[model samples]
Target: MTETSTEGTGTIEALSLVPKAEARQSMKDFKSDQEVRWCPGCGDYAVLAAVQGFMPELGLAKENIVFVSGIGCSSRFPYYMNTYGMHSIHGRAPAIATGLASSRRDLSVWVVTGDGDALSIGGNHLIHALRRNVNLKILLFNNRIYGLTKGQYSPPRRSARSPSRRRWARWTRPSTRCRSPSARRRRSWRGRWTPTASI
Candidate 1:
């Protein structure tokens, strides 16, 4: 939450104030009671495991961290983590995370979105968040297909556009196309991209 104040000089000020967690935390402490409901070999499971393992290293109280996700197979992430989170509308997780991070600076905000959700419907929100440099982390799951909607072609699908048949192939000569922008950002803004295997 935020509050605005006006001083004698007629200057307005917006303050970000959120209470910090007072208790120490562990990996088990961040596990929720809900069951993991993804498919047998879905990439979301691997991402979830990696996130769960990394959260404990943040050393923040469980209540101070928030994971916001959009509608997709990856959107079910909040249910698996025992923290403040919201499974929001399709392609709007970045917008929601923006508000939380802007108003509650004390909280650690994270966004979990898929290729279709982030690049198609939520592209505007994602770009604005990155442009503004919000204090949040956005994890874009690029599985190339809509896993939640049962194998629909996504925006990032590297397949030939033939009506008769569709097949997966490498879009660019090198797979480093995705990392180029992130690499540039790292050089200028100190943002690091943690590349995971096939997730």
Candidate 2:
């Protein structure tokens, strides 16, 4: 793979993936030197392990994979990866990943964001990126509570005692527009992968 740059845009030119005989990479190759620093027993640890394990399957060079994240506990992901990445502003990971993916089709771009970051502030960017099919693997860690904010209730938190609990309950009720099965089908048909699962 090769990359070029355009003046002032800071965007990488299209990469030409001329696969040559190269040695396979191990999981250690993707592991960074940074100390794994998160609260003990946090779910992020498992998520991190899962991602690191899967990276080798892609068979891409470490330099060609990028992890972009937004502000939150999950945003710390880029720091632990031994690949090129960006720890960007709150709710902007999708937008940044879109630009990078669109500009460098040869690179595998992934976004790591949490419920508050992706569903609350970055919701628009996330939906648009999916609609445009900008070649990205987005992982939304919906732990419900804001881990970085010390257990504060986030957008996905569902508890009677949660902050603004009633407001959230009201919002969860599907309106007429959101209840249409055809609309959901149309949206899903446009994307390559859009799966939701509890971790």
Candidate 3:
């Protein structure tokens, strides 16, 4: 479904980009035996459901997909999926995923990171991964607040009260906007809304 031009050669080779699955997949197929442990009514449940429901349409083999996540409450994502995955270090999922994608050309690499994990300490790592143009599906869940630490605000969270501050606190970084004109030009990016009770 794609083409790659050989260096120093004028001919372009067509590549069947995504590997066709040997069998049709189902939501149950992707559901791991591990218990679902996120906070009740957390938006992650919806994200998990949507992903599981849609995986079948991709016609991909479960074993061929991998999910990598960093340290955070959301980083526990790998545990809920049946496919192979890694629960990696803090703010290092993208860096790790890039290497995985590079070495395993036949596997589909996905990164699941939260606002703080991807935009704060992992900012540089995330930026470079995007620059590399590697085949990685980055899923950034911007819940607006730091859910795992439970004491501070995340990068995308606007100025607001925080647990650590106990009063109105300004954001450490400028509020993140969806308008990434530069990033949008090079790749596909989309957003969705998920209602949550609390973090």
Give the winner by lDDT. Answer: 3
Q: Model 2, stretches more than 4 Å misplaced?
A: 1-21, 161-199
Each candidate's TM vs. the true structure?
0.74, 0.74, 0.82
Model 1 is weakest, by summed lDDT over 10 consecutive residues, at 6-15
How many residue pairs clash per model?
A: 0, 0, 0
User: What residue pairs clash in candidate 3, if any at all?
Assistant: none
What is candidate 2's lDDT per residue for 1-199, written digit by digit as tens?
Answer: 1132213122222323412216787778778999998888777888888788878766777888899999988899999999899999999999999898877776778899988888777777877665554556677777766677665556655554645555535445222221245434323222222223343
Q: How do the residues 24-78 of candidate 1 rate in per-residue lDDT, one tens digit apiece?
A: 6667888899999988877677778878887776666777789999998889899
Candidate 3 residue lDDT tens string, 75-192: 8899999999999998999999989887877777889988889888888788777656566777888887788777576777765654657474553555453345444443434455
For model 1, what is the error of residue 22's alpha carbon versus the real structure, in angstroms, after optimal superposition? 4.7
What are the Cα lDDT values of the candidates? 0.70, 0.69, 0.74
